[model samples]
Target: MPKEDQNNLLFTLQHDFKTKLFLSYIDIKFKAVLINSSTSWYKLASYTIEEKNSVLSKIHLHLDDFVTIYEEDHEKSYAIIKGIF
Candidate 1:
């Protein structure tokens, strides 16, 4: 599929997130992060996948995405490559 199609597919993964994800911040362009209800934040793992680079790989987050945050992780979490929605 085209890059745009793949992005739309990944955006839909938001519903796949079991936890409550909120728009913590919005960077330039379509870049953004959805933070769970907890204070913890998960940076997007990466942008390009080594191969095939499926929607799952492009975002570095599977259907059920998760991460471990430090006590004061806060906005410092720079989950890059979890590209535009």
Candidate 2:
């Protein structure tokens, strides 16, 4: 897709869940996958995030696509990614 279209999608995703308290951040990861027939498909990208509270936030895009937010606690130290959509 065009850069502008991708940016607009990202912006829309951000706005959809800005009010939620649990979402810490959203990161986009793009990948290209090739099938046996040599056709390629662009994954919609992976959205990952860190949570600040116990509540699980629900994210929805204009297309009605959604991802559930959750927290992962480890003993090492402290870090967070607030949103992933």
Candidate 3:
């Protein structure tokens, strides 16, 4: 959809995820967003928010758990927010 809609959807996921679990970090880039795993270090899911927002939105909305988000972009436009989760 539109960029604004995508942004709103992302915010919704972020809010819901934070309410359910303990998020480690969330980063938003250009191509995708990366969510840090709560248990393992190597466990992470890189999601393309713009493309998969619809599907992911539904999942995240219902499952309010800690899920780190990292946006995909050149030079890594995303960063981890420490002590926020």
Q: Relative to the true structure, how large is the alpha-carbon lDDT of every model?
A: 0.47, 0.44, 0.47
Model 1 clashes, total count: 2
Query: Model 1 TM-score?
Result: 0.23
Write down the TM-score of every candidate: 0.23, 0.25, 0.28
Between candidates 2 and 3, the one scoring higher on lDDT is 3
Write down the lDDT that model 1 would get: 0.47
| Candidate 2 clash pair list | 24-82, 25-82, 25-83, 26-83, 50-81
Q: Number of the top candidate by TM-score?
A: 3
Q: Which is the better candidate, 1 or 3, if ranked by TM-score?
A: 3
- TM-score of candidate 3 against the unseen true structure: 0.28
Stretches of candidate 2 off by over 4 Å are 22-85
TM-score of 2: 0.25
Error of 2 at 14 (Å): 0.3
Stretches > 4 Å off in candidate 3: 22-85
For model 1, how does the per-residue alpha-carbon lDDT over 1-85 read when each residue is reduced to its tens digit? 9999997885666545423233223323336564554342354445765555444445455324544444464643433234323
Candidate 2 RMSD to the correct structure: 14.0
Q: Which ten residues in a row have the lowest lDDT in candidate 2?
A: 32-41
After best superposition, candidate 3 residue 53: deviation in angstroms?
A: 44
